[model samples]
Target: MARTKIIAGNWKMNKTVAEATSLVEELKKELATFEAAAVVLCPPFTALVSVARLLQSAPRIQLGAQNLHPAPSGAFTGEISAAMLREAGCRFVIVGHSERRRYFGETDAFLREKLLAAVAAGLRPIFCVGEELPDRESGRWPAHLRSQLQGALSGLSVDALSQIVLAYEPVWAIGTGRNATPEQAEEAHALLRKELEALHGATVASKMPIQYGGSVTPRNAGELLAQPDVDGLLVGGASLDAGSFTSIVFAVQ
Candidate 1:
């Protein structure tokens, strides 16, 4: 089963509506005819509506949201719900990002509900899992990664699990200008695939796309994408500019 490459740009916290519109306008032109990989642009909540409108013309590129609350209609102030994101024209939503773990104190148990909500609302989740610098140094990254996958996905139905796209973003490397070598990225992605196989079955696991994130630049995107298990990228800073992001997309070969 050949999984299509999915290159998603997580424009976390940056990009006002105006800035997001400008960037997507450029991306629409550059990626208008690109069909090698699936491109997803995750803008901040504030820009979703505007970006969604802009993307109507660029049908190949999909719209995604940075995060979503589990509850459908919540009293949770400052939280966006899956239904809201869906109505905003988001086909995808990022779940369990490391920043949400570190800053907002999102737990795997909590994220499980988020996954349920996302799928129930017909939104595919870009579920992020990774280790911090200390965990990597202590050689506990494998166990840490396993814990994250199992903790959130243990009891999910095959239908639910099928809607997920996993992203391996080393906490230390994100936004630090340092990236994992292609070998290192492959090792982590392979481990994640193995874990998924155990939790689900080989057929289901093989169909799932596992993406690599963390300081991914156009210069390194090609080598990283060359890894067998590294299906795509969850780009950060490099995705801010349309030119650089387009270059990363064109690196599919």
Candidate 2:
């Protein structure tokens, strides 16, 4: 069975509410009848509600958040809960993005909690995992990726995993004008699928959707998506612009 492609744009730390609205309005116009892939736009936390409001009229497009707190609610100041995100009309939320892991020092144990929270709150999670340049060069990427995957997904049930989309964003490539080659992307994606099969089973792993990120653009999107195990894309900077983002969305066609 083929998985429906997903094109999720992670507008990290960019776009005020007004700018976000304009971008989505442009996206709505271009993707009015577009249904080639499931589309998700993740804006900054401050813009989620406003973006959600705009997305209400465009059901084809879905709203997502860049991050969320693992706890439902608490004294954890400066945190947004999954329940809050759901109430704001977010159908999806990104968890354990590389930046979060790097800048905020989020551990895999903590990411697992966030995944559980997101699912429990009825929001799908786009869980990210990847290795840095040194790891890749030292041939430690396999071990690093395995650790990240096992650490975060160890005890999760297959049912819970079903509600998640896995993303592979090479740390060195993100926002650096570098990206994995189709062959490299395929190798990594295939490994991830194999690992999933080991954790669950062939049936479950085969049905899961895995995405590639890191400096993706219209020029290279088509070739990247052509890889057998590469199911979708997790777009970043290019996604901030309506035209470029739309081009990347339709690149496969």
Worst 10 residues of 2 by lDDT: 196-205
Encode model 1's per-residue lDDT on 145-183: one tens digit a residue: 999999999999999988999999999999999899999
* Shift in Å, residue 22, candidate 1: 0.7
Model 1 bad stretches (over 4 Å): none
Q: Estimate each model's TM-score.
A: 0.99, 0.99
